[model samples]
Target: MIAFFLQGLAIGIVSLIPGVSGMTVAVALGIYRRLIDSTKNFTKHWQSSLDFLLPFWAGVAIGIGLAVRLVAYGLTTFPFPTAMLFIGLLAGSIPLLLKQYWLATVGRKQLDRPLQLLILVISFCVALILALIQLNSPLSGLSMTFPTLWALFSLGVLSSVAFLIPGFSGSLLIMLLGFYALLTTRLMGFMHDILTNSLYIDWNSFFFVITFISGFIIGFIIFSHFVMAVVINYGQLTFASAFGVLLAAPLAIIVCTKALANLQGSISVVLVMSALLFLVVGFMTTYVLGLYSTEFTREHPHQGS
Candidate 1:
């Protein structure tokens, strides 16, 4: 129970970062398939699975509850530094994912080395080019308004779709919608007023939350089930493409983050260091949690060969 909650909370926090994905973090924590299986078979493993998932879901809710403000403030006051930190973390974690996927193919004598190398080279080059471009990526500079409720709902739906997809990042979708900052601000505003006055939740804010949650729930459940089915049916080719997209994402974030002009300052070094620290933390957390474990063959009983 405790482990699941902690893991979910950690994943939830990671999901707030632009380039990071809760799905990846869940995979890193060794719970990706388990969660899906449990969700699908909610009848059989209700006791144990719910014990693990409920707290994790609660943690996700809480982390988002808190992050709604902190991320907003960070972006508002120190956008570039914050973005740089996230980019660094994203860059550091790529190798870990690569290592995991590589190990998954161990014992497969039929696996083509050339094809694997080709995929890696192509992914690396594409990521490099994307990194260079994002450094100067233009901003929309758009703000959210009450009249834009439909737009916000739509953005939430899109983000939810990404969240459900294996290699996609909900935060990246938020960035694409240009409301990355706007929604963060509104979330903070909602939080501030909530604490200032008892029983005074903003109806508008509440509606957004309800709508976003609705979209996220509907999208995540349906898409995850479908994707899981596909993976079960076609594991290798599907994984290769998924891995390619995953590799491409952090590169995109790194590029776009550095492109922001405000990234230079005295605190930049410290921030970068902090980001590196978290990057290491992310790697260690994923590694130590048995997320990248290559010894599950006996238990899962798959023919890597």
Candidate 2:
């Protein structure tokens, strides 16, 4: 349970990155299959699945609650280092994914198959296009109204779909839909108000929050089943596509964060070193975690599910 919570927290933290999918982190951590299996088969194994998922959900909530504020502040104050760190973490996970791929396809000629190759290219291109679109789009703040609330609910559903797809970021979709700023700002304000004065709350904002979360829960459950079916039927193809998307994520993050643009003019040696250091640290952290997760899974293959 503690392990699940920590892993969920890690996923939540990384999910803040524009192009980084939390599901991708689960994949890298060697728990993607277990997560899918448990979620999809919850009816058959409700007790065990609930025990496994409860802490994870709690951790996700805690991580997101903290990350929204911290990431907002970081983007405003220290965009470069912050972005570089996430980029490194995403990059580091790639090796672990490749190892998994190699293990799964060791005796098969799957990668050489034309259909698999096509799927990989198509997935990569689609993710690239989506990332570019998200990067170029402007985030217009939405006013709280019935229409906007419905839109937010719809966005939440779409975001859940993105969450299920490895390397597709739900937050990026929200940002593209022009509700990212409004959602984060309102959530922060709501949290502050609750902490400061719980009795005098804005019911309207509370309603919006509840509606969005409800949409996410519904969408997540539906999409989880769909994803589980895809994985079971086409494991290699699905993961191949996911691998392509993962490969594109670092580039997307760099583009979205404008990190390259910041470094283009009069690059300082100290700043460059600092960025490099942070990147390396992030990479090492995730890589080590990946190794640990791999070992843990091997030792307790059926412990969680």
* lDDT for each candidate structure: 0.61, 0.71
lDDT of 1 by residue, 1-305 (tens): 77887877887887887766577666666677777777766678788768777898988877887776666666666555566556554554555445545445565454576775566567556555645544556444433465566666666777876665444568865664455655565566677677788577776666666666676776666665675655443344444654665566654554554434455545567666765565566446544544354333333334332
Residue 89 in model 2: shift from native, Å? 1.1
Clash statistics: count for each candidate: 4, 0
Prediction 1 global C-alpha lDDT: 0.61
Candidate 2 segments whose C-alpha is farther than 4 A from its true place: 27-34, 41-45, 103-112, 134-136, 145-147, 165-168, 172-182, 198-208, 260-265, 295-305
Return the TM-score for candidate 2, rounded to 2 decimals.
0.79
lDDT of 2 by residue, 150-180 (tens): 8878877988887886546687566544566
* lDDT, residue 189, candidate 1: 63
Considering only N, C-alpha and C atoms within 3 Å, which residue pairs clash in candidate 1?
134-255, 134-256, 135-255, 135-259
